[model samples]
Target: MTSSTRNRLFALGALLVAGAGLAYVAFGNIGQNLVFYWTPGEMLAQGSKAYGPTIRLGGVVQPGSLRWDAAHTHLSFRVADTDQPGAPSVPVLSSETPPQMFRERIGVVVEGTFDRSQTFTSSRLMVNHSNEYRPPKPGDGPDKWKTTVSAPTAEAR
Candidate 1:
């Protein structure tokens, strides 16, 4: 081919190589950076492939399922997948102290990996809160509730 034609072909090949490099950098080994979150039901559905990397499992803390070790301050509880209603439970083991909002029937988010024993070795624990809150009215200041409601004076009438 002529010199100009050769230059054009080289430019096209360089562009193709750059595009492929970009694609590999973006999509290659994506699993290493992915922090997946799923419920107990989803994890169970994933079968044995759910282990290895870190993950998040959320569900309500089953009542009477908590077993605390006072010596080590380690706590274990079963998190039932609310989606399945009465589905099988997944156990969570945490060495950290649970949040104050944590209680039976309360939602919890556990971050860790699930082993073959179905036990989630959590590195982080978070307790979900209800969406209910009482705020003061517009006219009511921060200390308005503390103010006494006095009767109107005769002159003011």
Candidate 2:
């Protein structure tokens, strides 16, 4: 090939290599930031394969399994895939305060790593509130809905 042709071909090859390098770096960064969501059952099913890396654990907070320190800084709870009997549950530990809407039987998504002890140590906790809203049924008292807002007391007047 001619000298000019050779130089043009070399330049084109360099450009392709640079493009590929850029694409590689972009994908590497994306993978590092990506966090996969898994349920307790799925995580357990993965066995030791799920131990490393930060992930989001999604499940319902098991009733009567929630415990919090008197200072409210440390919290522990069990997350179950299903509320039905015989369903498996995963224990979770967090140092942060639980969300305002967090309570037993509510759905929660916690971002953290699973330890060798089978406990998930969460760095972040989020309450998953449902978007659906339903009105109170007829003949039901206001107290039936624990979330009903109470009126102001006379002492505040």
Error of 1 at 66 (Å): 1.1
Give per-residue CA lDDT, model 2, range 1-157, as digits (tens). Answer: 9999999999999999999899987876765445456778888998999898898998898877777655656788888897665577899998766655677778999999997999999989988788977776887854552342121121112
Candidate closest to the true structure, highest lDDT? 2
Give stretches of model 2 more than 4 Å off: 1-36, 135-157
User: Which pairs clash (backbone N, Cα, C closer than 3 Å) in model 2?
Assistant: none
- Summed over model 1, clashes come to 0
Which segments of candidate 1 are over 4 A away from where they belong?
1-36, 83-85, 134-157
Models 1 onward score TM values of 0.59, 0.62
